[model samples]
Target chain A: MISYLLRRGSRVVRIILFISFCNAVLAEVEIYGEASYENRYFVEEGLFGQDKSHSSFTLSPEFYFESEDQKTSFTFKPKIRRDSVDNERNLFDIQDFSLVKVQDSYETRIGIRRDFWGVTETVHRVDIINQTDQVESFDGEDKLGQPMINLSLEREWGTLDLYVLIGFRERTFAGEKGRLRLPFPIDRNSAQYESSAENLRTDFAIRWSQYYQDLELALSHFSGTSREPEFKAALKNNTNLIIPYYEVIDQTGLEVLYIVGGLAFKLEAISRSGQGDRFSAATAGFEYTQVGILSSSLDLGWLFEFNHDDRYKDSPIALGARLTFNDLYDSQILSGVIRNEETGETNVFVEASRRVRNCCRLSFESVYFNEGTNSNSVQKTFEYLKQDDFARFEFIYYLGN
Target chain B: MRKLFKHFLFVSLFIFLNFTNADDFDRGLEIALATDKNFSGFGDSQTNLKMLLKNRKGFVTERKMKMKLLEVPNDGDKSLIVFDSPRDVRGVAVLSYAHKVGSDEQWLYLPALKRVKRVASKNRTGPFLGSEFSLEDLSFQEIEKYTYKYLRDEDLEGKGCYVIKRIPLDPYSGYTKQIVWIDKTDSVILQIHHYDRKSFHLKTQIFKGYKKYLNKFWRPNEIHMINHQTNKTTTLFFEEMTFNTGLSEKDFTQNSLKRSK
Candidate 1:
């Protein structure tokens, strides 16, 4: 696969050279690049003791070259990072590299990637995974090595759009003994499973989006299976619990005289099914924006969710609220019953951010999670505040024109 | 010999009248400014004005406005006007002065959204209502905005006029330069050549259908600007203009911006 990709890349380069030669008589080629750095700190109190801190500094650089005619363009980006914890020392790593091409209004990209998904915005990092555990779920540092290929195409028609993506990966997983045991019951030792071998996998996804004035609707589907033994084992064990799901998100909003806005409606359903069992969830919510009496913009929203499982004959309901001030401060509260067994859970979180300048910001966040039992309950809380709070700062500077 | 002397006298009288009229070109501009300056002279006077604004696409729109002049000056020399029409923008007002450096403010009340926004100290060369009429074009021509050089006597639209070229003094002005044709009869501006910042001829504004506002002041009821490059046009019609109704500076304050109507 590596050789094939290199051959293709060389062919593309040759084509670009030919095109440049042909256009060299009339126009000049332009190359541009930009670089930025970000420092993030996370503090938490729970699980593995009272105080745990993770700090990472990241550098992202991108380059692009275009023909004078501008009909064709190419872009490349490489991300690198350095991380430190407590005062114990530090480590460096390379993340991934991406390449993109554009022709007219159509664009094509292939590379190891990270993307945000879902109406509620979930993070999904493809291919590269050095750090096993992180909230954003991707390696914090650049590895310079281990990159995957990702391809995507998108087209628009009037107010409607269609997008498709495909990804290829070759990865290795640790053996099943010790810390690598399967999380659930599965045929981990089967001949079909190779826990510590090189593997290949493919993922396919499609999305359709349509808009009418202020109303928008989106429907997307992703279905792919990986061949890695660990993944296969995990899938087999959770087959009953893992369902192939589809989601429909619809949003209708209004901007009253370009101010004092409000949006009403529901996220009808997200349903999944596997074998003979079916699982589904639905939510409805309303949001409003108003000038608070204190001369600040305030957003208030409420949501309710209902979930059902045919195999377990379980049904659950959840309620949530979100309040935001000046779009910079936000607080959320959610409580729900997990199953017909009446397993209850509640979560609350608040975050605030202040812009130091065009390129810098200061932020603070805290979260609390509680699990309720028939007779007793357990609770965990996490909070993170910038230490220098007053002195800690980030700066983003641009180079070139 | 006596017949020859009589003929020469008649020809010389004709020449003297023509030269005097030529000299009165600036006087006409002065009269036009003075007519708009006197507030009490115009009492309940109504007139219809037509405006045409053009872009690259040629004639884009035409507006017909009815204007009512209320009061002139204390001695009844100048006037104030109010505009009414184009349902979306009915209660808009403008106060103008013939003098330079004096505050000439405009207030607009949008009834649909129930808010009044005051236009304050804007660049004179900026477009009015997204049209080619710069704020400078609407306001009375001030000497400070431009340095005028009298060119020569010429004929435009069948009227004898003094052609003068003016270079704008404002460094940030949208127009690099301008040329105006002032009628020798009443100081009426008949045509103007507007140049872009790059010193390129961008547009031309023409004035016509002159009417005497108070017998001494001739105001053009129709004006048209043709964008040479874009071939588009925009027209503003002053439906109703009332000169003076005891409008005070207090009415132009920020507190009144949200409640003008």
Candidate 2:
């Protein structure tokens, strides 16, 4: 085991050396990223066997290099993180490291990267290129980088991108002591795959996006091993376990947005063919903003979004679908306010300073996982998550030049 | 010879009559529009700036950001600002597309969420990130967004200038009116006094250290804004600037905002 760890460690060092050498060779370098520490303290005590609080420290550094003419560039962002509660959650990752070359009307990028596609705020039904880094956040705000070679062509009509993705990365799950988690701890050793080639399968995707006046639209198609895994109950370490089962699937998605006045309407729909019958899902929402609210300099935005998954309307796999489409609530209405205080413009923010989420929210969120206390259903994951609904106060300080 | 003298006298008299007239409102708009037109037609620009914020208590902090502006013909200009320093704001970018006919569209991209949230462009009176500058102050400063009133012609710092009071057409402005001093020699803003919504003097901004870039573009090397009520001040220095950059409309898009360094 020591020799195995040594080999992996040496590989990491070699890659880091190679990347730094490349950056050194390229002169014009721009370095960026942040060092941040955040703690999330649960309001109440642990449920069953969880901790009352969780804290993490992160150092995410990125470097970018481009030529004088800007035709060729290399971008790299390496993240190192440490978590107090869950040892499995602490790790290192290459969030984005890509080499890109731009030609007339076209650009080609090769390496690990991150890509997003979708318009709705509630759920990202159309964004599936990168796997979810589940331990990072409960909102699915973090993503694992995907290894891909992408060629993009810009035409008068729109921009077209074709991607050949390799090195399939599996979605991670929360550890046992984590707050939001499945009923049983997921056993990575028991993972199963539909394809015999398994993790070696290469994925491919193509997307075309266009914006015209008040309307923006994009259509994408992806075919490969699914980033999402299905869990089946199993016996492991004398405890009930949910063994991850990976499957291959094809997904086509369309995202659209239209803006009129101070409001914007967004829709993201996806149709996939995978385990069980064919299914389709969509998240539709609209954001209405009241500018300069109440004769003050504040802006208030009201967001109303609803998600519909045809698979969830069914009986047998409804609860499973809920677990798969975790953050997507059936109906969610959130209102947020943003105010730029005239006093703390520099370093004088008092209690809650420069909050991007700004003011506050009393959101009404409802989702149905299942109506039963069945041990097979992971409905408890969502039930336990309700305890994490919190009102947080944050203080932000700007560091560095 | 007599006819030429008579013609010149009549023309001089006509100019004198309008010069001292009470119709300063019309002249105010003319001066304002002339100032706007002088800075027009430069395709685009890229600038690096360092900002210093100091409170009344003598505490000082610094910030660095990169700004890119692209001029839109027959309309308001579009700009993109990416904050590079201040690790907390690293990778935060804002894209603003100003229009001549309507409210501008501004989008703020937060790197933590990898999401671009829309900001109400009309929320212009509020300070921008605790700085003395507002959304309108950093915007394209389109002439159509305000109504002008010429106050007087005065000599400021030995240079001829026209002082004007401009009222924003948007009612939500934090100030009822802003008095501006435009230098006549170079058509640049020399000073501006911002009033609160209650029509009281709140802050004053001065532009100094002017440098001509690309021979035709005159940009201020340093700008100091002082808040009278709070005794706070923020100063911005344009560390480096380049005009006529080859930036297209694509660089100002939402995708470009996300990709900003």
Minimum summed lDDT over a 10-residue window in model 1 chain A is located at A380-389
Q: Which ten residues in a row have the lowest lDDT in candidate 2 chain B?
A: B118-127
* Cα lDDT of model 1 by residue, B125-179, tens digit: 4445445566567654555455565677899878898787777665545677888
How close to the true structure is residue B156 of candidate 1, measured as C-alpha lDDT?
89
Docking quality level of the chain pair in candidate 2: incorrect
Off by more than 4 A, model 1 = A1-46, A49-51, A64-71, A86-106, A113-117, A121-134, A137-199, A226-261, A266-278, A281-284, A291-342, A372-401, B1-261
- Candidates' chain A TM-scores: 0.51, 0.77
Across residues A20-130, which tens digit of lDDT does each residue of candidate 2 receive?
675577546765555455566666554556876676655565777777766677888887766767766776889889988877667788999987777876468888889
Query: Which candidate number maximizes lDDT?
Result: 2
Q: Which candidate tops TM-score? A: 2
